[model samples]
Target: MKIKYAIIGAGPTGLGAARRLNELGEKSFIVLEKNSYAGGLASSFTDEKGFTWDIGGHVVFSHYEYYDNLLVEILVDEYLEHQRESWVKSGKVWVPYPFQNNIRYLPNQKKWECVRGLLPGERSEEEPANFFEWIINTFGKGIADHFMLPYNFKVWATYPEMMSFSWIGERVSVIDLKTVIKNILLERDQLSWGPNNTFRFPLKGGTGSIYRNLAETLSNHILYNTSVVSVDQKNKIITDSLGNTFEYEFLLSTAPLDILVTKWLEKSPETLINAADMLKHNGVIVVGIGISTSKKDSRCWMYFPDDNSPFYRVTNFHNYSPNNTPVPGQGRALMCEVSYSEHKFVDQNKVVDDVEEGLVTTAMIDDEDRKNIISRWSINVNYGYPIPCLQRDEALKILQPALESMDIYSRGRFGGWKYEVSNMDHSVMQGVEWAERMITGQPETTYRIS
Candidate 1:
């Protein structure tokens, strides 16, 4: 097939690009999707027992008006809005979301330890060298030792020393001793500290519903189950696993940038090869523990820092929407997330069992509740998180421009290899902005190389 634009992967970014191109009255593009479904990592699945599960715990919220309008157009009133009720599990205590801001909820000794570490001269006065140093220097050794260090290692599945701390803008909550003391004295809970303080979710299809609906509008342009095997950048050609070939003037790949460069791109040089090697990512295993019983927990999700749970976080999935459970308003869908990487190897074969036992250890479910467990569904995501590794920026600078010079643009979560802008909103806008830039001469903003 011949086309003006060929987009790879039908996730938020590809769909966003396709949708925007269509809206702009451009009709000569095709979207080749590997799976029979849309949404990529954002996709959801329904088990035989009729329980819905997202790839992981995905909450719907946006920083882009374009994405906000896109949701309004796609979902209309079919979604549910909820205030964020996120928390952390520390010393069998349900501390508020930002663990640092709510250390006062800890047992008296641990609480005192956290406060003492935050005192003047406790933190390093020198600039941090890496994420680990930054955590200790900015948050003090106590908070780092108690929560930041352990929880982060569990979640990211990569050593903090290997990661750069620049991506901590809106993702992490900063602490101040004055506010921490005031909150402790007045007993104030810092409930809202991040962008997702209030978010939305699909009332029926889990989080994937938005992408599914958006793709439907451009169904004629999307070719499902067509996986791109190789890219002939010199000839502007693409060959899929089905033995079909697509030729395009421009290509937008939402697949992993490493996969695109190292595996797919034809005749790639050593510089690009080494650059792709530096791109670090973590895998996630989503274990959905569905119980035939119900619970009245208002907290949406809770983070685990201690060894009580193999998982770093668990969601009260039932609270996301009553429809998430088989019988509305009944049963609990406790979705647990366990991240793994080579640096932190997890026995995937036994993670489900570990997760169930961890739930018991953390007091999320009782031994009696285990008897009530009806569904044990799990999905092993090979590429769950795109780690902002020490060499990430250096890698992107070398890879993105080299591909763009060949009229290929890689954007979105793994494509851009940027966790900060990997949210649903940012992914979609990356596509939308890519389309806009293609149609007109407007420069892109969301996925900048720098």
Candidate 2:
């Protein structure tokens, strides 16, 4: 088959591009997805007990107006607006989210340590060499030791010193010494800090419903269960697993950059191959446990920084929407994210048991409540997180432009290899922007490596 454009992967990015192309009345493009359904990593599944769970804790919030507008158009009235109620578990105490802002909840001695480190004369003039140095330089030793260092290490599955600080943009909350001091003195809580403070979710179907609806609008253009096996970049030809071939002028790939370069490309440059190997990532095991009743009292999510829990984050999935659980008020669920990599290995077969033990150890579930768990479901995703390591930018610098020159526009979470722009909104906009650049000669602005 011959086409003007071929989009690989039917996730948000691919769907976004295809949706925009349909809106523009362009009909020369085809989307090929390996999975039977769309949404890629953003998809949801239901357990035997009828509780719905997302791949991870996926909340709908956007930094771009276009992405917001697109959701409004697709989901229509089938979405829920929610105020973020998040917390952090420090031993037995529950500190409100943004642990730095709510240090008043800490013990007297701990509070003094945090506040004393925040006092003047700790700021450094030299630049930070990595995320660890950056955190200490920006937040001082107390906050870093208390929350930032441990929590980041758990989430990233890599040492903070081994990762780069460039991707920390708005993903992490930078400290405000004055505001923190005022909050501590006033014994007040500061809950609003990140972009997801107020977000939305699908009221009926799980997070995947938004993308499924969007895909439904362009269903005829997408080819499901078709995996691209090889890419003849020189001739602009793609061969799928079923012995089918497609010829295209422009290619938009949402596959992982390393996989695309190493597995699919017929012949890759030595530097690009080495760069692909340098890219590091962590896997995630999302374990959802559905209980007969609610777990916490209206809290949306909680962060686990200490080793009390093997999981780094636990979200109250039932709070996202009533339909997420089997019954409205009587049924509830807990969704926990446990990350694993070379640095931190996990036993896949025993992960569910580990999560259960972690919950009891962290006091998330009591002995009586543990017996009330109606169903248990776990999914181990290989590409759970794209780590922003010290060598990531250098690798992307060598990989991206080389592929772009060959008519390959690789953009998305793993496709672009940029965690800062890897949110659902940013991933979709990257696709839309790529399509706009191809069809209208517009300059791409989303995935620039600096």
Candidate 3:
């Protein structure tokens, strides 16, 4: 089959691209998704017991007006708005969401150390080499040692020293010395921080509902269960696992760049292969536990930096929407995220038990609560967070333009290899922008080849 545009992966990016193409009255394009359904990693699943769980704790917040309008248009009034009620579980205390600003809740000695280390007097004209140095230089040794270092290690799996700090834009809350001291002195709660301070979520279906509904509009153009195995770039033809061949004038690949360059391409250069090797990511094991208790606390999610929990973050899934649980008032859901990489390995067989045990140890759930477990669900995603290593830019520098030269546009979370611009909205916008660029000769803004 011949098409003007062959879009790979029916995730947000592919869906966004298709949506935009439909808007532009373009009809010669088709989207190929390997999965039976759309939404990619942003999808959701329901357990046998009627408890719904997202792939991870996904919250819907956008940076673009177009994205916001699109979702509102798709979901209509089926979305619920929420104020972020996040916290960090440190020892036995619940520090406010920005752990740095609420160090007063920490023990006296630790608090003193954090304050003592806060006075900024540095003379480093040169940029910090890695995330470790960046943390120590930015937040000092106390905060770094107490929450930043260990928590980051658990979340990233890769060592902070080995990763780059450029992706830390808005993702990490840097300390404001005056605000920290003021909040500590007045004992104020500083939780209103970050762009996701207020967000929206689907009222009935899990987070996947938004994307699934969006895809429903362009269902005819989507080819599900069609996995592309190889691409003959020279001939502008692609072959799927089922031996079906497609000829395309342009290809927008939302697949991982490494897999595309290494496995899909007929031939790859040694340098390109080495560059692809430099790309690093952590796998996520999301364990969804449903309980038979209605929670009174309105906290949305909590971060676990300590060793008491095998998971890095846990979300009160039911709090996102009332319909997340089957029994509503009688059911509650806890979605836990455990990140694993080569540097930090996890025994998949025992991860569920570990998560439950850790929850008990951390006081998230009690022994009595364990017996109330009604349903359990878990999904292991191989490509979770794209680690921003020091070598990432150098590698992308070599990979992106080379692939683009051959009419291949890799845009998405893992496809772009940019954690800075890898949020749901960003990924979709990347795809939309890619489509606009291909269709109208517009210069791409959200994703840059450079």
Top lDDT model? 1
In candidate 1, what are the lDDT values of residues 224-308, reduced to their tens digit? Answer: 9998899999999999998899999999999999999999999998999999999999999999999999877999999998977
What 10-residue stretch in candidate 3 is worst by lDDT? 117-126
- Which residue pairs in candidate 2 collide? none
Candidate 2, run of 10 with poorest lDDT = 116-125
Point out the higher-scoring one by lDDT: 1 or 3: 1
- For each candidate, what is the lDDT? 0.93, 0.90, 0.90
Better of 1 and 3 by TM-score: 1
TM-score computed on alpha carbons, candidate 3: 0.98
Q: TM-score ranking from best to worst?
A: 1, 3, 2
Residue 44 lDDT in model 3? 88
lDDT per residue as tens, model 3, 25-91 = 8999999999999999889888898888998888889999989999879889998899999999988
Native-vs-model 2 lDDT? 0.90
Clashing pairs in 1: none
Error (Å) of candidate 2 at residue 372 is: 0.9
